[model samples]
Target: MRTILAAGALALALGASGIAFAEPVKVGMITTLSGGGAGLGVDARDGFMLAIKLSGSKDIEVVTEDDAMKPELAVQIADKMIQSDKVDVLTGIIWSNLAMAVVPNAVAQGKFYLSVNAGPSPLAGAKCDKNYFNVAYQNDNFHEAAGNYAQTEGIKKMFILAPNYPAGTDSLNGFKRYYKGELVGEVYTKLGQTDYAAEIAQIRASGADSVFFFLPGGMGIAFMKQYAQSGVGIPVMGPGFSFSQDVLAAIGDAALGAKNTASWSPDLDNPKNKEFVEAFKTEYNRLPSIYAAQAFDTGTLLAAAAAKADVKDADAFRAALAAAEFDSVRGKFKFNTNHHPIQDFYVREVVKNDEGVLTNKIVATSFTDHTDAYAAECKL
Candidate 1:
């Protein structure tokens, strides 16, 4: 009887602990891991893996695939993750179009979709899903910040440029919403276009006091290098995608003193941010960009939420995710009603670090506790 009582007590204790003894939680990451935009995806993947490692959870398994910046490929990968791999959570698509293609379908299937990078307005607004959460800012947040900064600086005329895509359209529209300035020119370049000689000539004649362009990864590097050589002599500004740490080395002196808007920076003053920055540099041997920072936050957030509730229980897991109890590299992190972050955006200037590597330094706060314009459209 004593032996049986002791065994029973042990079983009760084990049950009370609520330790997850179930199968590992599967997570699928589909992002632009190759081609021109590989740098952003690589940084995001590295940062995410680092967070998962730091979490020290043995029950999480991540499956990653290269989307190659193709929307159809991302959709295919999403289907595989859902149907074959049976991932409990899906995350990490870098482009707005790819996110649009995959997020809705994945969420509709009752799988939780956590966005690490792309936060298109449609997901944030009318089509907001209870199973969808954006760990990054909405697509327009950084661009809108740029516009606000331009308005504050009294720039009367600005030239805007972005690739002709969903994100590009949203970026320019966001900028226009807050700029309160006359547009000297609004040009949509072909996606992945390398040469900007024609565009630079037009900008030179546009008589714009400033230029704002949203070209990410290699596109930004190519444009900045050519624009610098063209001697347009106009102050350049844009969303941080064009001036992130991942591409700054390639951009070099051309990006120096250029300002951009972002929701996260390595120089953000907080314990979580400091730890993240040091760990990232130590692990990756490079400075972490906003892209990496957001990805890291996504991983940490998932770990925290998973710890609180089982991923198999969708409602419980969603509730835990909504709580957002993890410490974020971005100082004060919270989700708006639409599951997008309501956080501070800052103006960053490209400057050489002590080691002479080009990196962004925070110069000013562009927006404080800002929420996206689409939240009003979200029923949830």
Candidate 2:
């Protein structure tokens, strides 16, 4: 009878200490792991895994898959995660098109979708779902900041270019929303087009005071190299996607002094950011890009939310996620009504580091406490 009583007491003590056994939380990450955009997804996945490792949480099981940057493939993977694997959370899509294809459907099926990148406008607006959360900024945030910076710099006639896709359109529209300058020319190139000789020729003839382009990944590296060789001599401006750490080495001196906008940077002044940068560099032997920072924050956010509520209780888990008690590497982290981040955007310039490696340095703040334009349209 004493042994039974002692065992009961020990069990009660463990329960009261919040150390009761719980089922492992299952997570599914689908990102572009191959092809032109692989670098971005690789960084995101590395950062996320690093956070999970640092947390030392044995109760979290992550399943990662490569989407190859295909929207249909991403959709299929989302279905598998939801129906077959029964993952509680889904995250890590690098492209807007892929996110659009997977996020809404997955969320509608009662799975929480935390976006580490690719915050398409539709998801941030009328189609917003309670189960969807964007750890990254809205798709337009950085582009809008670029526009504001262009206006501040007194750029009278700016030429703009982007790939012909949903994100490309959003990027150009975001720039136009705040630029308030005459557009000398606007061009939409085919996605993944390598040669920019034709585009450079047009820019040279457009008589524009400055040029802004939204070609990310390998496309950005190709364009910068060609543009420099073309000798257009026009100052280049863009969002951070085109100038991130993952691609800067490839872009080389061609991107030097180029200014871009972003919500997070490796040099951001905050305790969380400092730790993240140091740890990321040590683990990956590379600087963490905005994509990586967002992914890392996603992991931290999930760990915090999971601690507060069990994944089996959807409502409770959602509430904990909405509470957002995690320390963000971006410094000020909060979700707007649409589940999109409301944060500051800063202009960054490409500069050579002490080791002569190309990287971005924060130059100025472009927007403060900025929320997405589509938040008003979201009924949720």
Candidate 3:
């Protein structure tokens, strides 16, 4: 009896030792940082790095690449990250077109992809994969919120503006989903366009009382600056991306009172948001954009999952992340079946904070029990 018990104990000890020597977690973060889409990607990278630091993560090594907002480049970098670099998980994409390409490939490679933003529509639908998750709103979720708000504000005639691309179409469709208003015109701007004089002229010609747009990054600055000077007597509204802290600082007072909708804001009046805003300001010496907040939340959630999971293994970590319950800066974040988030969307007006930095102040939330339209696509 003593010999049998000793043999069992010895076997258990060897098994535990083998588990301890498994592997370190390798994370690949693919984003846009140097080319046409630098501004958004730079903020996302900084925010994600800051999150890694705050988590005091040592067991994980993250290697990053620049997709340059090019699909071919995205695929190339994803291949390197997956094959040569040996990443166990992937994260951080800033655009929907990029996400649509990057995420499916990552999942196909049998790796976990945690998105900080840019949830493509197809992922929420027919191509949904279990190895993926989004830490931000769907591609059209924010646009839909703006649409819903337009309906609430009694907007009758509207003109929609977006870049000529898949994301732009998604944004416009998202807006139209909730906005039961007459469409005066639907216009597409050049991607990364700065001069909005022609478009502003078109708006004046179209006679739109309410203008909805989906511009972001440097384009937002130029568009808003031009819109303010265009003498177009209309209320401009959209989601909080293109005109948040990063571009707001440059646009300054021009973006004041422009209404946008989003799931998180610095002035959300939540304990976690307040803490995040304060810490982010101190660390970066600027107001954090919603992109930064989303990246931070992604890190927090990942750390929580890793702490509770057998993270040295990929499948175990994915399961753990799916089951994670982290304290979100947005407050109470969780995943839906499609791995998209179920969160509130607030209507915020661009306002000057106490430090003279432009930020958003929440006016009203368009959704309380918001659910993305793509969950039924996912079998898991």
Candidate 4:
């Protein structure tokens, strides 16, 4: 367990009298930090800690652990964090399967789970809980945006593939929800798969005009590199995870001109986003990824809620969190009935920046003030 120290120019007072609380708010973060998906988890941790540091609240103490991309390990870490650490809030999970193993248990045990990423459909639908909130996005939101983009572009037959995990399955389902096109092929690869020789052969034979995939982290890096080498001429696209800042350079020109969808971008014209991007780059000496942005938003939202209500008061704190009164990096951010984000999703094309670094630029807005399809099914 590591304690993150707060240091920044921004000052935040926790109580109504503008003073720090007697007892600190304890946060437990269980995420992948040493595996194929380590990059995503590392960025999430850095971005979340950065936001907490910038909030300048000495009352927030975070204890973190590496889950190593295993469900059992994540469950063990979550139990330790909640029982031994006595954490007030649980956050910072990157994968949906791990979240499934931890969130319901943590929330049911009276710990608030402010999800930084991995908003599984079950959590957002009939099984919704008052103590669990997803500050990032629903697992399907980004893929749905990509589907809308493909529909607008008049894509006829699309070949899509994803890892055979909760998030991966949600990705393809979301795409199919909004993509008014015939599916040439749909393949489910192994989670954390590194090779694409077999998938590439299938894609080539499918004769699809375009391809969509949901391989993230090192898997994306490996797949894009192998896909490039395969010499298959089909245009490829996916959600922002595949082309995030952490993996873009590794993907190199393979991701160039590929369109992806996201809720927030570094270039988003908002004061909070501008400050966050500058602070992230200055503090970390590198650009932040979509995972980072979501985690940062989670931290900032918690800070805002902490300012209004004490973590000990469940009802007040839940109301404060649901209010979502913080300025988000993505403009016009709000929470739906299901505790998922209702915001704009944009289609961004991968392009080389003026500094010759591969990055994304918003090409079109796919959905504005969009709520997840499952929100209506949520009773809460």
Candidate 5:
């Protein structure tokens, strides 16, 4: 009698504990966290952590992995997230090629993939899947904004520089689509190469009145420094991802007064951005990167959908996210037909903040209610 009573009491205690804990919602995040791309993943992690804290709920758990800036590594991370962690949703990815590898696997397994950055054009077109949605613009979206700026600014001669890759091609084509400028030169550099002295020399010789450069990470740092020292005296510009607060610490005064196009800025005239910047800076002791903002927005979006009780299953949650109901750091974001953003892109000039931190200030807008090029390719 005593043994039976003890066994029953133990079972009751176990059941109560299980009921109290419930089952935590699992999200898998993969980014380029090694090699030359560690900063991107660090920013993304910070953003998601901030969102998790701000949610004030213990129902969500994120499983994060690093691709080491390699495609095969990304695939391995996807398998781990799906099979080992048993994640219900997938997000995070800083490189276009890496995102391309992970999205298909996540969708094939019928899990939703929320891309915080690295929007590949193929995923927005014929390869479009119902389970994949990008919080970031298509790879060329901001490049098109730069093109529009060049046209509006009456730039006749322009030099284009990008790391030789598919994204480099998109960067050039996207710019030409909007700018009637003479193609002074379109040069491709090594993906992670440092020295830009040769390129700056060529740009000076090309006689271009303006330049568009798409170097990111340390490469962005190197190019910005070189451009400032080159005495080119031309208005250099590109997408905001390469020159925003993330790389400002590295580029310092070299990025000052430099212009770029983006859909978000820390100082935008919106309450959401105001709250995010303050919270992020106070917690992290550094300016939030655009990647960080996008990741935070993704977390809130997914959590809100879950809180609305839409994610009893994965499909319902994806539909809710596709509706674009979440108030994002990029204010007033709506979806294009291709499931990419139709947000406004602004011309941002790098400037110092009140706390002596470098940041971007909006000077003008490039596109209003602008959509991606692949929307026509998507049947929806």
Candidate 6:
């Protein structure tokens, strides 16, 4: 009888603890893993998983899938994660189009969606949802920083280009919003186009004093190689995506001397950032890119919230996430009313480190405590 009474008392104590009996929070990660853009997604996934591993929390369970850079595939995976896997949160999209396809519906269905890389304007503006949060900069933020830098550099005539997609359009528009200069030419190429011969010919003939572009991944690599060989020499610049750590070595010395805008760099001086950079290099044997930093910040944000409230309690969890109590690697991170980050943007220049490897270093700050222009449009 004493044993039975003792067992009942222990059960009561366990039940009173609440979280001890709560199911682990499941996170669904759908990211590009097999395509031209794989490097971005792989770094994002690695950074996020590294944070989870470092936390040593068995209460967080992550399920990962490859989206293959396709919007349709991402949609199908998000639906399966919500209905079958019963994920408490969804994240790890690297492209803006895939985020547009997955984020709104997932959040509408009551699953919190945290962005690792993509931040489309519609989601930040008219279609803002309480459950949707963007840990990365808005798609236009970095481009706008480039524009500001160009003005500082006294480049009055510039040529600009990007792929013909939603993000591409946003990139040029953001540049124009801040440049306050004459555009000698503006061009949008096909998405994922590896050859930039004709574009280089056009750039050479444009008579622009400088050139700015927004090509990312393999596209940037191809363009930089071809442009270097063609001898355009117009002083190329762009957002950091065109010259991120994942693609820097591939770009080689052609990327040297080019200036780009980014929110984080390996040389950023902060305690949390220092730890993250060192730990990431030790874990992966490579430098972390801007995408990786954003993903790591997202994971840290989730961990802080999870520690404060159970995922099953929607209001409590949402409030805790809004509080954003984590020590972000970005130094100063806070969410706007639209749930997008408001942080500093810096101008980074590609330079060879002591080891002769291409890397970025902060040369100037373009904007401080920067808020997205579309934040006011968001009703939430």
Every model: Cα RMSD to truth = 2.1, 1.9, 3.6, 6.0, 3.6, 1.6
Candidate 3 ranges beyond 4 A from true positions: 1-22, 312-315
Cα lDDT, model 6, residue 192: 87
Model 1 C-alpha lDDT per residue in residues 1-380, reported as the tens digit of each score: 99999999998888777855645779999988898788889989999999999899888899999999999999999999999999999998988889999999999999999999999998999999999999998999999999999999999999999999888999999999899889999999998899999999999999999999999988898999999999789999999999999889989899999999999888899999999999999998889988899999999999988888889888888999999999999999999999999899999999998999899899999999999999999999
- Per residue, candidate 2 scores C-alpha lDDT tens digits across 1-380 of 99999999998888777725566789999998998788999999998998888777778899999999999999999899888899999999988889988988888889999999989998899999999999998999899999999999889999999999889999999999999989999999999899999999999999999999999988999999999999899999999999999989888898999999999888889999999999999998988988899999999999888887889989999999988999999998898988898889999999998889888899999999999999999998
lDDT digits (tens) for residues 1-380 of candidate 3: 99999999998888787534445677888888887678778778777777777777666678988888888888889889889998887888887877877788789878888889888888887888888888887888999999999999898899999998888888999999999989999999998888999999999999888899889888888998898898887888888886687788888787899999999888887787787778787888877888889988888787777666655566777777877588788877777888888889999998887877778999998988687877787787
Report the Cα lDDT for candidate 1: 0.93
Q: Which one wins by lDDT: 5 or 6?
A: 6
User: Which should have the higher TM-score, number 4 or number 5?
Assistant: 4
- Higher-lDDT candidate of 3 and 5: 5
Clashes of 6: 0
Clashing pairs in model 1, backbone N/Cα/C closer than 3 A: none
Candidate order by lDDT, highest to lowest? 1, 6, 2, 4, 5, 3
Looking at candidate 1, the ten consecutive residues that score lowest on lDDT are 15-24
Model 2 — TM-score against the truth? Answer: 0.96
Measured by TM-score, the strongest candidate is 6
Over the stretch 2-101, how does candidate 6's per-residue lDDT look in tens digits?
A: 9999999998999898767666889999999997789999999999998887776778999999999999999999999999999999999999989999
Every candidate's lDDT: 0.93, 0.92, 0.84, 0.90, 0.85, 0.92
Better of 2 and 6 by lDDT: 6
- Please give the distance, in angstroms, between residue 286's alpha carbon in candidate 6 and its true position after superposition: 1.0
Question: Between which residue pairs do clashes occur in model 3?
Answer: 216-242
lDDT for each residue of candidate 4 in 1-380, tens digit (9 for 90 to 100)? 12222322123334443535446789999888996788889999999999999988788899999999898999999889888899999998888888988999999999999999888999999889999999888999999999999999999999999999778889999999999899999999998788899999999999999999998888899999999999998999999988899999998998899888999888888999999999998999888899999999999999888878888888999999999999899978899988888999998898988888888888889999999989888998
Residue 266 displacement in candidate 5 (angstroms)? 0.6
TM-score of each: 0.96, 0.96, 0.92, 0.93, 0.92, 0.96
